[model samples]
Target: MHNAKPLPTYLVQRFQGWKATSYAENSAWYRRLASEGQHPRAMIISCCDSRVHVTSIFGADTGEFFIHRNIANLVPPYKPDGQQHGTSAAVEYAVTALKVAHVIVMGHSSCGGVKGCLDMCSGNAPQLEEKSSFVGRWMDILRPGYDRVVERKPDDMARALEKESVLVSLENLMTFPFVRAAVESQDLSIHGLWHDIGSGSLECYDPKANGYVVV
Candidate 1:
């Protein structure tokens, strides 16, 4: 088997190098950014897949976006169970604290997590184990979409599953009290984007059209 160990090491080296280069080339900007605090224009909820980086894909520089990533980009309904609530906490910070004007829930093509839902692959399903793997369990938040998509469209299974997952996450975003308040008060707007990694393009969801249009 091709070991994956070398990849993280390579990435660490590259990240260190990038930080050094940034310091050398843009020390003033970096310093200013560090001092000024992040005033990101948008709060992005995206998949944790290393292949799909919100900043890199959006061509955003440091502090341009407040980002929260999780497996399959899933967002659970607002829950107060005395949990760490990382995603919820980030959303709270972005909306209430940072006051980001826009919030985007972005999904991507060929997502292994999405594919797992479509295929009903238990191997990829999340569970709370002795070792503490929680990604799969978190992905369960999007399971309703998987079931709904399968029931609604038995054909063209893949696309339906992916699209429905985005819709589901969008719906869940409203479950947060702060998000709903901002949305209702017009302080924030929410957008959904389906990214085509293959074509290096994005299709934005249009609530008016009830579909995605290339953007």
Candidate 2:
């Protein structure tokens, strides 16, 4: 195997400081967690964007959330076709193995992945349409969501589609038999959320309201 370069000095120093401070203060708790393994209560599927801090937003402690991040925070419909599927694998593990009580799909405003899907669907981003484009193929999950929001004004379409991504993921999550069974059995619940980065606002999907409401 090829030898990899060392970590950046700044990151190393920051980790050292955290270990000396935060980790030191909670060493017993950390040790207990290490010995018992994790038992997170929720599974949060969120965008890969650096600005959306899942744990910080919920004030979650370590081992409190089983988190997964991907472009656009989209979950494709369940397909057991003997192919490689990372998101589906994560979902299966979270529901079946981890037995998380809640599965939350969170989207964000001004998401580049959402914008790319909008552009690609609008015929403005031909590069993303290429067969070799992983992002484009992965974003195919959001096309139905775009169709649902296409009637909105041009300026509002992007944000609408962003919220739609959360709805789409929540819907797709149910397509998995294990997830559906868990939800039906009342062992698990699903939620959709959208975060406005600039405004520091959060909105949750309300089935009764048929749209997102401020949280």
Candidate 3:
């Protein structure tokens, strides 16, 4: 492996600024959190897209949410093969150890991962079809979601697939016994959200309405 490089100057400066301002102002709260450990009320599964800022959207404090991000924010179905599963591990820890009260799967518009999935499913991304492609394999979890949205008109395909990613993740979360247990015991609630980047709008999936409603 190559030697690791130090952080860029801009990022270092930004960190120093935050340390002087936000950290200084909340030192006591930070110390208390360190001593007691984080007890976030929610676990958020969101896209790795830089545009979707979960904390900013909720105006949440540092220790208020446990966030896990992955390509397209997809969660694979419960699998216990003793292999490494990063997303699954995060979900397990959040549900069984932290006992987060809510788990939110949030998707967004113009997601590259979703586009890749769309291309792969449509046989347009031959590279992703290779067995050794990590992104491709990870996106296999979203194939069922693609299938659900594939019949839509071409103009609406991408957005429908993006929303389907959120719904699929929510469904897979329930396949985990701990998540289901928490929900059954009235300790956990699951949510699906989609954000429109261009419009700066947020929508929540309402099962009763059978569609997303602006929030």
Q: Order the candidate numbers by TM-score, best to worst.
A: 2, 3, 1
Those runs of model 1 whose alpha carbons end farther than 4 Å from true positions after fitting are 1-16, 121-133
- lDDT tens digits by residue: candidate 3, 1-215: 47989999999999999999999999999999999999999999998899999999999998999999999999999999999999999999999899899999999999999999999999999999999999999899999999878665547898999999999999999999989989999999999999999999999999999989999
Per-prediction TM-score:
0.85, 0.97, 0.97
Query: Which portions of model 3 miss their true places by more than 4 Å?
Result: 152-154
Q: Give the TM-score of candidate 1.
A: 0.85
Ten consecutive residues with minimal summed lDDT in candidate 2?
A: 146-155
Clash pairs (backbone) in predicted model 1: 126-136, 126-137
lDDT (Cα) of model 2? 0.95
Model 3 vs truth, CA RMSD: 1.2
lDDT of each: 0.81, 0.95, 0.94
Report clashes for each candidate as comma-separated counts: 2, 0, 0
Scored against the true structure, residue 45 in model 2 reaches a CA lDDT of: 99
